[model samples]
Target: MAARTHGPATTSTWAPPSGKPPLASRIMRATWRGLPAKRYDVGWEPGLRVPAADGGPLMTDHYFPRAEGDFPTLLVRSPYGRGLPWSPMYGVLFAEQGFHVVLQSCRGTGGSGGGFDLWRNEAADGRATVSWLREQPWFDGSLGTVGPSYLGYVQWALAADPPPELKAMVVQVGLHDPHALFHAHGALNLETALAVGTGMTYQHRGMAAFVKATLRLQRRLGEATTAQPLRGAHVAALGGEVPWLDEVMTHPDAEDVYWNGASLGEVAERHRVPTSLITGWHDALADQTFEQYDRLRRAGCETSVLVGPWTHTSALQQGWPEVFAESLAWLRAHLYGDPSGLRPTRVRVHVGGADVGGADEWRDMEDWPPAAVVGPWFATARKDLTRQAPADRAPLASFRYDPGDPTPSLGGPLLSRTAGSRDNRTLEARDDVLTFTGPPLTEPLDVLGPVSARLSVSTDTGHADVFTRLCDVDPQGRSVNVCDGLGRLRTDGQEASDVTVPMSQTAHRFAVGHRVRWQISGGAHPRFARNPGNGESPVDATAFAPVRITLHAGSALMLAAPADGAGPDTAANG
Candidate 1:
């Protein structure tokens, strides 16, 4: 998971250099011709001071359409600073689309006064900013919120008490649960935390400083992640102690009082704001977006979701055209009473193609996880996946997991350049990994919803972690990951137990001749901190041990396929 990143890049293909309208126009025309045409020249105001709840001045930048007409405001709050992508993409380009865009740095970053404390002050500062907006002469009393990554978290924080002026929201690759972001099912998501720490510590300083910090982290990552006492291991990469990172890392327990009020997911249930949730299949926070959509939909709030085949950063780069268009449509329909641009369907997802088969295309649906039927592919001692049930109870596979040499994590849903689907032959070859391969499919199998693995297993050590993955294996034997998840096990001393590991949601097509695969591993290292194979806290453990894990034949891979025509495909005939 090296080179993992969060938020928009300092520079973007969508955001051209300032003072060069010709270059910007040419780039947009060449790459994003489908977007709505620019309607106004943008006006900019830098170094505006907006007071926080406690009178601490927060640095802000306001970008508006130069014309005299009243326009809806787009409030973008981010801790990553107001420059590059934020200015050109959100400030300039969006302003050109006939909206007033206010880009503000969060408290204690980007020249804003006060200490940054992660999720603590966002709600208060958001309210304060809205209060400030009301006093502005140009404000038209209608507001919409938009941003990505941490920027999205700020939107959720603001929605804790949805301002009367807030008519719509677009949360791209957003996060709601701070606990889930850093820890997955009790194991620490080590690499993402480190990358995020680097971003928070240096991004506001300037691009050069941020790049330097990122390079330093990459150089020292091996040393930091392998440190004896995993706690405080990030000091070297981060250049210094980041209190919030330290706090979150140490407090892995979601129920800890230390995390009180850290999650703002409940806000979605309470508000009826027209919201658009955007995420990539491989984005680290894609599950969060799915959760947001589910909550919003269940509450009968007007909502839609767009999922693309991209990683966290790529969603803003390679997928920017579609992302920007979807965002503009949602904002226009909700904030400006113009629904013409809105798509007829509530869901749009990019169904991925296999190396040799499956159609690569965008699909529109009335709702997400669109009426899928659950099908189980049972694992066998022969290392084959089949629709038939196990004949009898037996150990299907066994592997030794050594903490000294843990299984390395390959690409899939990480926040890195290396994130997303990648050939998994190297990973599947590891001694600690057990793979079950299904027969080549005769027909395309479209899996469009959540995938999970139900395993009956026992570990020599009472403590272990299970990492299960679903993959698409093409004709030439290239096994690429689609979705995966990690779950920690705590059993009563070597006793067999049943544990279900949710592999998350995915929209993918397993084409003809492509075989489905279920890969099981003891752990995916640095993507998750190596379990010390003891009961001790993974973060604080200094002693390491080797553990042997066994999987029973009854274990099965569960996939959600469309109720019609989508199911476990039978073996292709000779």
Candidate 2:
């Protein structure tokens, strides 16, 4: 689809205001002044307050051009302060593209005066914000939303209500279920979650207070104090102390509260907006994006999904420009009555591995799960090694899991820092990790979606931990982790086991010279809270001795593989 434009301009007409100022003010003024000077004229207007459903007033900052015409509004509802760098960047860019951009600090955040309650009040507040935007003097009554992570979660929350003015949305790396995201994976993911959560706390207090408090905390308690205290406080102060975080630690089972907040499946069926979701293939939350995409398609919602070879911060790093372009095209088509090459259903992904030259490519399909594949791979274990193939009987393998020196996290989607350069060679050397591989492939094998492993296992103790990793063993013998999945084992059925644990999906091509391998282990430390190997005790129990875990090779650790001729056909036309 293509939209018509008037014509190209031939002029050097726009100029910004002249001034020098403090850094933060300079950054803000530059953004406010420079963004409009190029293609859009940015101007701020005050007195915008929408009444929350509960009678509280919700404050908002509106950014639009001086043009004397009504245009659709692009709304961003964030718990983080609206003036923050990441939040404002989206507002400036979207405003430059001709939408009336409104950035509202949700509930207690920023200039908004209220106590924060996480996602509880977002639905009503978001609807109130949209209704207010629709009634504005220059509003066209059409609205679209965009944001990453927490901000993205608000978009979904608002859409779940199907607000009349809401038309479409772009959500990047947002949480679908708080339980699954923050705790369900049987590990803390403490660093990344805290980095984001504490960042929000810092934003809520303005820059000055945030920095002052930060320095004081550092001096009093040491540099790590700021991050750790916030995390500890969040867990301790959780309403009802619902044991939300602790339950995640103690009960790794997906029951009760964990299932309550998981929203992707529900949002897909309830929200009717045309949506675009972007997530990193390596992201800890990548499963949410994929599951949401599938649910949306099955529910008959218009949607597009993109998974790239980037990490969690892809939006600010190497892939941002392209991500921006795609998002802009979607907004233009739906918001501005312009449509140029926006597809109805597609999943474009960046393929990673030593082969395929590491590039992104688009793939179109009528539905997710692709309709052309079969899932069949069984676990095969011999000695201490495990593999996946068709199996009619059981297999076993064994390893010891020591809580003190548990496996450490290398790199993945949930990590705060970049582990791009770190290799997995050292991790493979540990006795606790079980590694298996197929002979070097004779041709390129492109893996482009979610992966799962099935294991028939029994532990020496009543409980155990399982970590399954997919890796690429290069011709040089280096093993690089591409994707991984994990589960905590409790054999008495108090917790779930034997079920397939889905790992994060990825796009990678295994070259003829490389080997496709799976590494099964007990834990990945720091990235996940350590699984104190004392079988039946609560995770917080401090006293425990390590236990030995055994995997029966004749029947356990099955690797599921694509059916015959079900792999990607490189012989076909690209």
> Each prediction's TM-score against the native?
0.93, 0.81
lDDT for each residue of candidate 1 in 258-362, tens digit (9 for 90 to 100): 989999888888878899999999999999999999999999999999998889999999888889999998998887788878888898888776324333577
**With candidate 1 superimposed using the best TM-score fit, by how many Å does residue 63's alpha carbon deviate from the native?**
0.4
TM-score (C-alpha) between model 2 and the true structure: 0.81
Q: Write the per-residue lDDT of candidate 2 for residues 26-119, one digit (tens) a residue.
A: 3654634312233665555433576776767677767665444555788888776755564346665666567777878778777676777656
Q: Where in model 1 is the C-alpha error above 4 Å? A: 1-35, 354-359, 565-574
For candidate 2, what is the lDDT?
0.62
Weakest lDDT window of 10 consecutive positions for candidate 2: 8-17
lDDT of 1 at 220: 93
Off by over 4 Å in 2: 1-38, 46-49, 185-188, 206-264, 343-345, 354-366, 372-396, 419-422, 492-499, 535-539, 554-574
lDDT of 1 at 508: 82
Which structure among the candidates has the greatest lDDT?
1
